[model samples]
Target: MLTTRHFLFFLTGLCCFTISLRAEPAQFEPEAPAAEPGLAFLLPTDQFLRQELDEPDDSDPLLPPPLEDSFSQVEPTPNPDTESLPDLKTLLRPRFDISAEWEPEADGVEMISSDLNLKLPLYPVFGPPPPFLTAGYSFTRINAPVQLDLPRDLHQFSLGVSWMRPLNERWLVRTMLSGVFATDFYNTGSMAWQFRGGMFAIYRPNEEWDLAFGALATGQEDIPVLPVIGATWRPSSSVKVNLMLPNPRISYLISESETRQQWAYVGGGMSGGNWAYNLRDGSPERLNYREWRLVVGWESMPPRTPGRFQSPGASYLIEAGYVFGRKFEREHQAADIKIDNSLLLHSGIRF
Candidate 1:
């Protein structure tokens, strides 16, 4: 039902309206010319599971970087425009993200969640080196009305490796493999384990455009595998258009200085997770919750360091959104419960 309404369609309409009112035409000058494009910025849904390369170096040039909803970081690509590879030391820096989200009581339920993710670059003295080693932990607490049948607490722990290898001047391959344990902590076993993986071919014809095609395995019941078709288009120095599944957004540059930049964005996406738990009857079951989100947010980030590759600098974001199409389903049940739409608040800091 929610998919039919296509919340993403409405989000796109609203995003375009905001862009038209504030976006201004500006000259485009790319100082760096080339680096690994940021897929995390392009696709927020898989932010924690993947890696992105390089931070936004405001001085190095290229259109202003787009807003990142999930703050995923990856390894930087060696500039294809240059003959030499990027210095290994520059790519070894680590990036960290911390975020929290809340949905106030609505339709008999409320939820709060927090996440911590780290992206660390890895290298080997011999053979090819892996680009990144990522680890994350998440905790969620749900307060439900007496009538609801749900677990009060849930947790997820993940570890993964991300790799990016350039095929040529304009093409690159990025892939990630991760194992996740999602449970109520009471049900800690194979039943709680889930595997996620993804691979994409990215095409950066120039500094202003990036096109990616691939699929992501989410390990959820309702939609286990999600296709990844995404594009990033910078129409001007002040505006960026991101067309991607699960999360799509348009961002406008609000202000900028030599060391920092601020942004405003409107976007929407699918948000939910699945976990395993033991029922009071001693039966092991899986619970899946799903929803759609429409959000407007603001963020601030430091400029990219010159010459040295860096993850996105310490940044912060605050967002408010509408959550709809909410539902809870069980692994082998004939019936599901639906909840009324509600408002959500989210904020995060990354360093």
Candidate 2:
């Protein structure tokens, strides 16, 4: 019975195949025209249809595929114009620099002292100084033997202004007027006020060089005169050296700006002067004083989108120095004056 059933199934499949073979074949027609020489496979049917709908039949040939980037290939087309642009370097350079320093020190039981100093319009106080003006005060104390230290406390205050104009590119005409008030041994030092006038010239041959010569005439019960000449050289942005003649003073300044907006400066100089006094007889008293100063200071400015003449900045400075000088009375005086070398340090801030 099972063999008969298998034979019946096979006969049914053969009959269906015979009927399919007699049916006519359905035909396929090529949708696109024949391919042309040099042409590769045509774009997919959907993409070809979309391009035809968007562009007119007379459209220009589509751009060639970007040439393989070989040395002989023509340069690629630049991108279309856009608003975004690269930053310019000229806008990134810093335009101005500012700095300051201070120092103070303590001696033994004899004394404790402090000094405050500042510089402004810091780029060499350049241009014809138009109406230069300054005001400052100083205080000092002494703790020696009462007989030798009458009026051991001292105070000095001053106000000064000057009018300066450029005589030429390298020279200037400088005239100044100033007044001072102080308490000291000299009548001028004790006076309520004193006046002074001076004229000076400044010559700068180039950005790295400077020369200054000046004579100051001071008015008081006793006249004091000062004639000075000085020069400076800046070999690099971070280093400066200076020399003064006659009194023979030398100075150097070094500065650097590191990351984190940290900045530092080191400056030092040596200077000397002479003092003279005439005794009752023909004998004369002379004193020689010399000092060496050193200052190491740091500063910081607020984080800024770097630019020129931006405002609202502050700085701090610390400095120290040593001074050694001799105060000589007449040779016949009871005692030859002696002063120990002294050290000073100070700190200050500016905005």
Candidate 3:
């Protein structure tokens, strides 16, 4: 049987906890950072978004504060130049991205999915700013055995807002709220709609470490609610250790230049979705698909430039991994079919 014990061990080894010395003192730049969407504790999509927001940038103007008191102590510094608000162009800029994934038939099951996402920045009347508005749509095609009797096509549409704010020099809070319609088109009533949300509190004592705690409402049958706890440790300029649930990864910088950089990472996580649909005779049913994956992948993207309001022109990612613990379940039924381990391949692009 597949379990979470191995996943826990894998997270522990990613960070050995040895790098203790603090880096040189640095200044904190005040700007309207990007918003993080989705539940950090449950979905791979949200995890990927967090990774993008945290990626090292060539023009990053802020660095860890001077070490004082204990490793856990961080004092806020005042920035006198942050009184002005962002311009209209920066507030209205939008980002667009698209991705596709495929998995070959294994034990009579094959799957393909694609996603499109858009994010729009918002202007604040005063103070900092409000959350960004996000919209997304995804479609999945499943090829299964005749005996399974499942829907061939599934769809999910979501709209939400995400925001993050600093509580002090050492703490940041992030939250997301979204409503999703997950169904097979045949089911178009309230049965197909569900709401999910997440809130996370992050502690950053320095530039090298970030500790986080939060909770998530997944709106799924198996695990409806979950606690989010994790930490990010950067021991050097080129390595990052992310010890988090659902998805955990360790990345190493491979190559870099003024324009673009590349990195390779090995990681494992959970992926799947839950949907509602109608049978031929008008009976309502819920389908849940779940899978665990371990993979190595490489990603390429342009370095972030300060005051660059728009999104990156383009980015690319490709990965392949071993997939196991795959299963399909039908609610209010006795059918719980297990799928054999298979190979997974995925590629994505953003612009």
Give the number of colliding residue pairs in candidate 1. Answer: 7
Query: How high a TM-score does candidate 3 get?
Result: 0.77
On TM-score, the leading prediction is 3
The Cα error of candidate 2 at residue 221, in Å, is: 9.3
Scored by lDDT, model 1 comes in at 0.64
Off by over 4 Å in 1: 1-38, 41-92, 124-129, 310-313
Model 1: residue 322 alpha-carbon error in angstroms: 0.6
- Candidates' TM-scores? 0.76, 0.48, 0.77
What tens digits encode model 3's per-residue C-alpha lDDT throughout 139-210? 888888766788899998888776666666666677777888989999878777878777877776676777
- Local distance difference test, each candidate: 0.64, 0.35, 0.62
Task: Write model 1 residue lDDT over 99-140, tens digit each, in one string.
Answer: 667777777788877777766656444214345678888888
Best prediction by lDDT: 1
- The clash count for each model shown is 7, 6, 0
Model 3, position 223: C-alpha lDDT score: 76
